[model samples]
Target: MTLEQLQTLNSIVLHGSLKSAAEALHKTQPALSMAIKKLEAEYGFEILDRTGYRLGLTAPGKAFYQKAQELLLNAEQLHSLGQHLASGNEALVRLAYDAVCPHNLIFNVLKKCQYEYPQTELHVFGESRFGALELLQKAEIDLAISPWWPTFHGVGDFQALKIGTFEILLVAAPQLFNGQAVTNIDQLKSEVNLVSEESELRFDSENLMLIKGACKWKTRDMQTLKQMLLSGLGWGYIPRHLAEQELKEGRLVPLTPQGLDFSIQGELCLVRREESTLGPVASMIWQSFVPPL
Candidate 1:
């Protein structure tokens, strides 16, 4: 019914207790209960599952909660639009990008944003794997670009467009492989595999890490992985573009073990929450990303 009642219901669900929700909203338990009863009466459907030991949402209540969340987000966006219009300058655009995304591409887009939207503030967060997407879901960032995709079923109203693909090269110092082919998983697993730290955070059933080697080394950044590979400490996947010079100079050798796919490929995607429309500045930046030739 009213925004106040909707927020009250949301709080109750969020806090999972009438008393906790009351404390959070600075209201009493009786008032919170009254609000829920009013909503249920108006909708003619149960919103909260009072049968549970602790208050929980019923089937209909779950659906209603989703709709309420969407409505709340839209309302917040409307308010932000009004503020931007009144000031003639948007407040800020929070952006998070995966480290594996090409630096040149990102910097080029940033330059275009700075030139076109001088008044808008850009707060950039550099993350890896699903980190950027996690921030996007929390509404902490307005836009995201990462190689990571959502779970197989996907999240609510999240849209991702293919921006470009980066080659995931399996390379190592010649000493590690000794110029011998690494065809079997066992041989590959025997050597230390340098991989991104973000790989550990993935829990999706579909999005499994490329290297399942028993002996593994983790680095927070790609540069560190490259350095370790050059030092013959470990062998793992790195962006082909970053290792192009090394590959050409014979400093690193690609491993193509028989019956195994060594060259891992991935796409960079521009991801955003479809529930909220992009502001003018964010829109401009979003359109600047084109599929790399």
Candidate 2:
């Protein structure tokens, strides 16, 4: 019914507790509760399921929450537009990318765009590659940076523009190989230490790490695996970016026999859903990454 009510609802939905939401909104619990009740009565809809310790939004509440977010974003954008009108015409382009994707994809592209057209803004969200695809499908983001793979099964009709490709490498602590080299899967049989990625882990389902007789050592995150490698506990397939510094300093060794590295053919792509209004900023950012090649 009101902006205050919408803000309160959104906060409650985000924080999942009346007390925390009230604290975030700088309102007393009783006052917040009363305001929510008034809004519910006016809208004739139940928003919060507060009969428990953690309050959850009902179905209607979820819908209202999304609408509220869009409204708030519009209002904020309008305010920003007013400031830009007086100053300059700069607006942010939103992007979400996978962790393994090249870090400089957005940065380099944005730098070029700014150099060519300084009146534009850039906002980047680095996340899992699969998650980036979801943001694209939901129209929550203008551009998504991911590897060359169909994220959702059977959605092969999506458009993708390849930016560049990088190699995936294998790394192990110096002690893991006893100062020698590891080549084929036979040498790695049951000897391989399967270090797993914990953050942004949307892409690793379906036992993708099977290597002959390798013993799996699945940790919840990369830090653990990194520590394991540093401590000479096991071997892992690390992204070249995550290990290039270590490899350069001789902390880890390349396991590809030639003492080189194995490559998984990683590629960066700029993507948008088929049905969406990609503004001028989105098109420019995409072109900035992939030109007339």
Candidate 3:
């Protein structure tokens, strides 16, 4: 089928009716209905259950719609690749980082790219968990530096390099635990545990790494979570570097209890789609992830 027909079908599914899909596509209802009829005629099966007041996809229609989505995705990727080739240079490099990506390392990478790749434009944004991964999947960003690993198989031909290791420390305001070491997971359940929202990047039960079944105050940013802990709202696992000052000043105390390791290790990884080749400038930034001599 034609791309227009596929896109029309997608709009019908999204907007939930022929009239709404027609309005969205700026096409008349008759034209939209005719397109679906053509597809049904060629396939020898009804694509939609039109007997209802609203249009709904039949079993075959649902399956065909999934294939249409894949076709649309590949078409968009093909267009982007063509643009990249026509530009001679990649022109723009989009980088996404999670909360745990070391600030010092990021600055170092950017500083070097500034001097070496002055012609290239750099765009940076912060994302946590698999949020950054979602951007990469959509080809919205060139690379992702994330602390969480891919939880599923067949995540495209994405290459990931271990860039650094950061520390995750479970700490709380001194009075949150009433001067008692947190030995059991259940002890913190009653208290609000400030934590990042559950993310798709977590392959393991890292949520259970902390106090399982605890009432959690979910936050979008790790810095915010640290602030919540500092305010005595809850306790959570904060990166060592981010909480260094509080730990040193005695505002936040690291939990140390027998049989419970409150500290966990986290890896900072550089991720990118393997199919896309980086320009010289983007390649320079990639190399900056390496340690200095």
Residues 1-293 of candidate 1: C-alpha lDDT, one tens digit per residue: 99899989989998999999999999999999999899999989999999977899999899999999999888877776677667656668889988667778788888888887665779998775567777887788999887754461255467787888777777889888787767777778788878777533336322244555357777767777889999999788887887989999999998876655688777788888888898888887777775456
TM-score per model over all chains: 0.62, 0.56, 0.63
State each model's C-alpha RMSD to the native. Answer: 16.5, 14.2, 14.8
**For candidate 3, lDDT tens digit of each residue in 1-293?**
78888888889988889889999999999999899889888899988887888778899988988898999998887776676557675667899987776689788879888776555678998876556766777788988887645443255578887798877888899889887877777777768877777655435244655566777778878778888998889888877888899999999999765566788776778888888887776777788786677
Worst 10 residues of 3 by lDDT: 199-208
Model 2: ten consecutive residues of lowest lDDT: 197-206
Overall local distance difference test of candidate 1: 0.80
- Candidate 1 local Cα displacement, residue 126, angstroms: 2.6
Best by lDDT: 1
lDDT agreement with native, every candidate:
0.80, 0.71, 0.79
Off by over 4 Å in 2: 1-80, 83-92, 112-123, 138-140, 149-153, 189-192, 195-204, 217-228, 257-261
> Between prediction 1 and prediction 2, which has the larger lDDT?
1
Q: Comparing candidate 2 with candidate 3, which one achieves the higher TM-score?
A: 3
- Candidate 1, residue 158: Cα displacement in angstroms equals 0.8
